[model samples]
Target: MDNTDTPSSARQSLLDATEALIYAGGINATGMDAIVKASGVARKTIYRHFATKDALVAQALRERDARWMRWFSEETCRAEPGPARLLASFDALSSWFATPGFRGCAFINAAGETGDPADPIRIVAREHKASLRAFLLQLAIEAYIADADALAGAWLILIDGAISVALVTGDLQAARRAQAMARCLLPTFFAPTTKELP
Candidate 1:
């Protein structure tokens, strides 16, 4: 019942190890022994930190969500908040794709493996995607794009699709292709007001 190590370090150690192992080997494949080995925390210590494996996994994912969203926001929203920032999302994605051990999206991967929509992990996955969609919508709204909702939805699809395709095909250009496709949609969806006409 005693996690022995300081609460913060013990909990964070489990979270760190669980995130890496789950992302690399998946929920079913990554066992407690592996986590114990990677974390160097005892079994009882893990139980003291988390009641169950699912609890540990869910917490790890929540931490991962915070970390991933922060990094993604810094990458995509660092520039001016308009069309440029919106388009820069794809560029950010491209850079991420090029990174070592890039495995597409953790949320999507987790969701695909989850059967129960009511599961905690599934909820976290949905939360992650919703955050992304909301960010895209905000950008579209700021850019005064017509039908911001629809454009944001489309961008989410394109982004997720590009990630999946890139993971499967090992083609880093998938992000660029998706971006090009997104670019074409801009003029198509954009409606200029008569007052703004040249």
Candidate 2:
């Protein structure tokens, strides 16, 4: 597909249009006609690019995951490594929560709609979440946290909770609260040394 902004290719246009519409109204609400209209691409062309609507949805989600992960990494990595980097993750999330038309997480929404665990879209969503956990684990290890796996799991829960609350209440301060909780939990889980018992 052509990469230029002027006269974007049919596939790219369809993906972009579908992603925007899905983000705004969700997959079930947005139909093929709406996608075609939004993309300014013929329905036939869209079918040519994607054999089925599910395929199109999966592809759109894949693109979103790639783009979002890249942006997330850049934002979180802007701070120095260790605890600062860990806390910076929440700052990045706060910025994202404040973005115009923020609609929580696309992957989480998709997972909710696709209840079947074996569904391709659901699989993509799972992969995206796993990637997020892995990134958090890396940060925990870098911070020299004891029980890094447990800390990463706790961090993921907090992060997910913050995003959910922020989306529900439109209060970006949720991330700050989560960060504060993380700070309080860190030293307990990451103590530099433990004394031997007699």
Candidate 3:
């Protein structure tokens, strides 16, 4: 297994290892030494790709977000845009939580570990949350909510709460229940229209 093939492959290998470790434990608990050992790559190789642990963590967060977004789009968009799509997002997240090496949201976990806003990991976590809020706001606008910003905020809180509760209790049912609530909340927030019925 000569991994010294190309820069691209090496970069991917590092990211894969980083994600594995982060998923297993968390960002703070996963150190460079663990990453090197888990990756089966030399320390130099890891350093070549990332200047520091912070850099590696930031890149890993971005990589995780990208993967999650792809999965979300595929799962949530399989059906029409309505309760189905909203439920699909939660369903997908629940499925992710049920995966073999199930762990809580990496961004949330990283933020907890960093504890300081100045940390690079914390910055990445903030960006992740901001992106989710923006996404929800866009969805609310599309749904024709009178106050898109407020509705998005409310839904975002519910979504976050569901995720947190599911992780804390190790119960997927919480998310499903939350999904159902979202179905009700959506229609109530928006003005009565044909699109709102679905």
Candidate 4:
């Protein structure tokens, strides 16, 4: 069923609009007026839900993280819990990074706009990263890694590091390297094969 007719749906539209703009541009660059205009929702409505621009930015990051996590769960489950799904996630990230006008990860990019470490936006950003690390650890375990936590941490560092490097260097070859490294490091956890007597 279409949800656009509901208040919750309208609120979601506002969140989606804000996220798209803020992610494509920067949180500092996207203002309340622009969000209201693009979302076709009244400024009063936005203010009604979110008291200030900072609140909106924080909510937008949370919503963005939720949506991303949902998509990641789906994509990472498309194949068996091993190299195939692992590589698929990298492919998805690469494609997302290559999307038109993709500035960077909104949470990561937005953290710079705030001075306070305890700012809601920065908290949301940190939570998003932590959630990703946890998810990767779970995935690594299912892939049968001997030390799933360490392996997942390494892989996540590689994945996020690649994104940062790609955004800075304007090169995506790092994604390929990360994928290769993951494949190389993963097979060590598989159970050893037993020989069949002739």
- Provide the clashing-pair count of each candidate structure: 0, 0, 0, 0
Residue-by-residue lDDT tens digits, candidate 4, 66-100: 98888877867776776577666677677767767
- Candidate 1 per-residue lDDT, tens place, 1-198, comes to 324368888788889989999998898899999999888888987898788998899889989999988888899987787777888899999999999989888889888888999998899999998998998898888877788999899999999999999998999999999989888777655666612211
User: Which prediction has more favorable TM-score, 2 or 4?
Assistant: 2
TM-score of 3: 0.88
Q: Compared with the true structure, what per-residue lDDT tens digits does model 2 show for residues 100-144? A: 989998988889899799999999999988888899999888877
Give the Cα-based TM-score of candidate 2 against the true structure.
0.91
lDDT of each: 0.86, 0.86, 0.75, 0.76
- The residue pairs that clash in candidate 3, if any, are none
Model 4 residue runs over 4 Å out of place are 1-6, 187-198
Model 1, which residues run further than 4 Å from truth?
A: 1-5, 194-198
Cα lDDT for residue 116, candidate 1: 97
Residue 185 local lDDT, model 4: 65
Q: What number of backbone clashes does candidate 3 have, counting pairs of residues 3 or more apart or in separate chains?
A: 0
lDDT of 3 by residue, 1-198 (tens): 325578787788888889889878877688888887777778887777789988987898888888876676687667666555655667776676677776767788888887678988888888888877787676666556677788677767877787788788888777778777877777667665545456
| RMSD, one per candidate, in order | 2.6, 4.1, 2.3, 4.6
lDDT of 4 at 60: 82
